[model samples]
Target: MLLLWILLILYAIFLAPGSGRDEIFHALIRGDFADVEPLVVTIFSFLGVFPLLFAAILLPDRRSGSWPFVLLSMGTGAFSLLPYFYLRGRFKGLEKIVTPVWLMRVASSRSFIGIIVALFILSLLPLTGGISLNAYKDAFMHSSLVSVMTVDFLILVPLSWYAMKRFRGIPSPISFIPIIGPALLLWQQRGEKDNERTE
Candidate 1:
């Protein structure tokens, strides 16, 4: 994971293509999506959702010491998270600490998962009218922000799956489906807990 993070940083700095990166970045910052491709906008929005999902998975584990990385990931995406996973692997026996009961409840609650699903659906709405893959590709090739963000999203997919498996204990097949998969896995767990309580 450390090596992958290093390679990603090197690629983003030295190899990713895009000359109008500054302009695209400014436009996104200013909420100027009129000229940006819907696909790009959608991907950018999902970048935000990805961090929340990770927080849900990692915070409840308590032993991962993942809070700092999870917070940083809100802005840096996988750049912040890969390190947490790397450290977690290296220090598997880190003493478990007591996370706040409320924080843990919020992170593990169905309500929080519902918010994630809603945000993901809202982000996808931009692409409802159809998008041009070629146009998105052109933008990606010409915009460093877009290209790096795309790579970040790709990296998060497997990390999310692995985090779910490692922390949650079972690799739900649905987790391989990206945001929706993890959300579903959490939702299923919540449902199982409810059933257990009822019984």
Candidate 2:
């Protein structure tokens, strides 16, 4: 779960500057990027993917220790993977075959439902007021939003697919975590050691 939470934090960071939040602030409130830059947007935009991909790499499977934690992490991370999934389904031939399956899995998961609820709640934040939805609409037109969203889609789709593959009995050597595929390899190694010890 910690791993998954980390991803959510990153997602929030990356989504902030490019998403409706920053756009509305810039347009309506005339908030300057310089003011928000140091604390939030810019740094997050660059490094936000680390925690999520990190957690996903570090996180163990559901059967290992606490299943709920694993589920929660996967769910949250899955939400973070939304952009990736969208793009993969569009560009990758492999995803074209897998998209329906992925979609079905998403529809069945409680985590996906939670994301919807959370986004709804986030919009209600006092600072967000009521115009956030409008801002979100505007965010689509911005170049930053498109760039970030595209990158997000590419990274997340494979991660989600790998997770699904892991669940469905296909053992994958690849981990969804960015800049750290080795973590999954290490986990696999550890899993083998544990199994050998039991044997």
Candidate 3:
């Protein structure tokens, strides 16, 4: 994971190609989606969901001081997060800091997870009309923001699966479903815990 993170940084800095990144970035920041492709917007929105999913699964552990990286990932995506995973793998004795009860309650709540799942679905709705692969391909080749974000999304998918297994033990088969999968696993885990309490 460390090597992968290094490679990703190197690629983004020196190898990724494209122009007008500033314009697209500023447009996105300003909520001017009029000129952006639906696919690009969808992928950008998914970046938000990825971090929330990670927080839901990782933050409650207390041993994992990964909240900082997860918070930064809301803007930088995998660039900010890969290091946390790397350290998590290298260190087993991470200091057990106290996670706030309210934060844990919010992170593990069914209502919160349901809202996140709804956002995930909303993010996908933009692409329901079918996007042209060729256009996206061209943008990816020529737009650095699009290319880097696309790669970031891909990296987060397997990382999510890995985090699930490491933190939650054997992940549900449905957890393999990409963005929403890990979230579903979290929801399922929360349900089990609730059931245990009730019983």
lDDT comparing candidate 2 with the true structure: 0.40
The digit string of per-residue lDDT tens for model 1 on 1-199 reads 9999999999899999887436778888999987788999999999999999987887876556787788899999999999878887577554454456677778888899999999999999889878999988998888899989999999999989999999888687778787988988888888898899999
| RMSD each, Å | 1.8, 15.5, 1.9
What is the TM-score (0 to 1) of candidate 1?
0.92
Residue-wise C-alpha lDDT for candidate 2, range 116-197, written one tens digit per residue: 3344234234343223444434544453543344344455546544654544343454544332343344445546756897
Ranking by lDDT: 1, 3, 2
| Candidate 2 local lDDT, residue 174 | 50
Tell me how far the alpha carbon of residue 28 in candidate 3 is from the true structure, in angstroms, after superposition: 2.3
Regions of candidate 3 where Cα sits further than 4 Å from its true position: 20-22
lDDT of each: 0.86, 0.40, 0.80
User: Best candidate per TM-score, number?
Assistant: 1
Model 3 per-residue lDDT tens digits across residues 1-199: 8899999999888888786545666767788876667788888899878888888888777657777777888888888888888877577654554556777677768888898899899999879767877877877888888788888989988888888888878466666676788877778778999999999
Candidate 1 wrongly placed segments (more than 4 Å): 92-98
User: What is residue 43's positional error in candidate 3, in angstroms?
Assistant: 0.7
- TM-score head-to-head 1 vs 3, winner: 1
